[model samples]
Target: MAPGGNRGWLLRLVIAFSFAQGAVSMARPAVSYRALALGADERAIGVIAGVYALLPLFAAVPLGRRTDHGRCAPLLPVGVVLISGGCAMSGIANSLWGMAVWSGVMGLGHLCFVIGAQSLVARQSAPHEQDRNFGHFTIGASLGQLVGPIAAGALIGGRDMAGTSAFALLVAGAGGAVALTSLWHIESRTTSKSREEQGERVPVRRILRARGVPAGIFISLAVLSATDILTAYLPVVGEHRGIAPSVIGLLLSLRAAASIACRLVLTPLLRLLGRTLLLTVTCLLAALLCAGIAL
Candidate 1:
């Protein structure tokens, strides 16, 4: 396919990613709150939340290895299946262990979808176009991040905690299914074979040891940890501050919008500050923001 021919597919991929990410974002806090409703203490809630990240940490490299050598599209559908089941199951699970298990499933599904989607983007775009294409791709993630929590906050509370929690999970399941619409024509068979031939199966250690890799990983981890903490803890902060749900939603959306704007102007930002300086500045600012939130 011509470069231009792939644009439509990329657009569809972005749309699907947005919805899938939105669902996961929505479900996460709902899961936490629901677990609390089921008599879980703060420690149990933390453990359940941590489980989402823990299992995926073990699975990501292997999944990446598989995608490097095989088809990316297969992971998309498989991820959807896992995400949908995990979200729905977590809602109905009576025990904390069951919720933790399903949360891990959801996290694994997220990792699979992201790895496949990113690999697809890398495979389809020319080297010169990679920066712009990736920027566009991540806009989908920002949109989901912007919208998901608001939807969750709106839907997830009521006089009946169990009932509201179940509803949130159902919505998440429906959101996961939306990804299926984009599966058609997402990956061409020819491209898959070519990717398998061209991509190297780098060991996790080597990938980590490569120049700039460690720094990039650390930066990504810090940024993500900041975002995760904000999402998971903000509502609790809001409660303490007596901020209404609507206000909290607006605040989160504002933060996401700022991130999207930053991404939109990333090229200019890089031109002004260079990569290392830009990363440093952003990380520093994010750290301050996180600290402010804590206070």
Candidate 2:
């Protein structure tokens, strides 16, 4: 850790990310509900949800490419703007098409922010410290995931479907704004030249073929997909089971908190089992948990 590197940035990043992520999480369900209220069928809701992911899919790699060569801090503010605007606009939009557009914007914003933020982390941390730092960084996301829906559930309701939905979106926008606080001092001029040279266009295929790259990518993809499906579909399960939204939120938060706890103690765990064994064991446990959820 460098000077002022006593995990202070990590903490600030997590806190900022929590608020930003919380807003998005809160807004997502609200969007789904609001869409339903506006007469969107399950298929329509699915389409809208898919749109959020779809729009971002094309942008992720390019954004990553850019961040590799440029300042990560710029993307933070830009992402905040997009997220806030998207959430707020989605609320106000009277038509499904309008909602879809804004949702795409929100997704794009998220992609930008994530690319930038991840790049920042990679740039900032020492090699030996990367794993712990990255683990700590994601805790912010987990925290946001835990809090966002609860906030949404609290703010949205009362049969005034449109009204409540609008409120939720507006609130999400405000939450996006909260991420701005972390934007301060995010970029460092010192590392600019080194990063630019390193980020220079390299063959994507070459990078992918590098040692550990394939495995790492696969693991990340699998884990993220599992988590995504879990988050998206869990509420539907709850709805069918007649669980309250607040209860569902709490349950999800419990899971997230547990994950945070895991990360907090990741160093000890890693030391105990080492990386390969640790990943295998935890991922296997996660598989079992997913199965349990499905059951």
Candidate 3:
């Protein structure tokens, strides 16, 4: 079947992704709070947050290779299991190091889910529909981001910061589990078979040398680093500024809502400014915003 022929699977995929992303979003702030309550300072908190990305960094390529040669559907459940386990474990962990370890697990799980889902989209979508499909796919992430913080804010606040944050992590785990219900037959069997039959994988160096590839990678890395830092450190800022957890959550949700709005208007922006100018303008604006935040 052509990628755009039937979008029902895409809708289902979006729903599943929403829950998974939501769980991660909720857990991020809760982790920070829990760490703070456990006597971790800013530097220690930064290390824990960094661990959330570090452990997954090396695993991404291997997972992608595996998905290229095997089934994508299996990875989704595995990812969910890891995410759920990690969140729950993080909640119960007593020390900063233990929290870091579980945070790494959660990051690894997120990486797995993303790799599998992106591969699934590529394998199943027609070349012509790739852009549109990916846009739709990311809407799931935006939806999760929008809702997760609000939920976390509602649940996580009070004198017993540790206790409330732990409860929030547990709830996040439960939310991650909800994605399991939407994973029935998500991948196309025929496409999976065809991908397995393909020849040896492309080399990383060659891929990097391809036109626009390196630039895209760098751009993605920059945006992701900025976003991750903001997500992980925003709570710390709130704590220092005497902001309530509920208010912090709302602020985070507002950031997410803005992201969603940007995605929604992406096509129009592209039409108006074209890709190059749009990219330049957005990057410049983002850099300025970051600087303003720093100030």
Residue 283, candidate 3: Cα error in Å is: 1.6
Q: What is the lDDT, from 0 to 100, of the residue 248 in candidate 2?
A: 61
User: What lDDT tens digits, residue by residue, belong to model 2 across residues 1-295?
Assistant: 3522556676777777777788788777778767767877666766777778777889877777777775566887788788888899999998888888888898888887788778777777778888778887887788788788788777766668668868988999998898888766655432443563684588789989999999998999889778766665665666568666567667767777887788778889989999999999989999999999889
CA displacement after TM-score superposition, residue 289 of candidate 2 (Å): 2.6
For each candidate, give its TM-score against the true structure: 0.91, 0.85, 0.94
Candidate 1 Cα outliers beyond 4 Å, as residue runs = 2-4, 193-196
lDDT of 1 by residue, 158-264 (tens): 56766787788878878888988977667763264455366565667887789999888888888877777676666666655776555666677778889888876
Highest TM-score model number: 3
| lDDT score, candidate 3, position 183 | 79
Q: What is the lDDT of residue 118 in candidate 3?
A: 86
TM for candidate 1 is 0.91
Off by over 4 Å in 2: 1-12, 126-132, 188-191, 194-200
Higher-scoring candidate on TM-score, 2 or 3: 3
Q: Which ten residues in a row have the lowest lDDT in candidate 2?
A: 187-196
Candidate 3 C-alpha lDDT tens digits along 1-295: 5555677788888999999999999999889989999999999989999999897889887887788785677788889888988898999999999999999999999998888888888877888889989998998899889898888888988899999999999999999999988877666432554664778789878888999998898998899888888888888988898889898889889989999888878889999999989988998899999788767
Task: Give the poorly placed runs of model 3, Cα more than 4 Å off.
Answer: 1-5, 188-190, 193-197
Q: What clash pairs does model 2 have?
A: none
Clashing pairs in 3: none
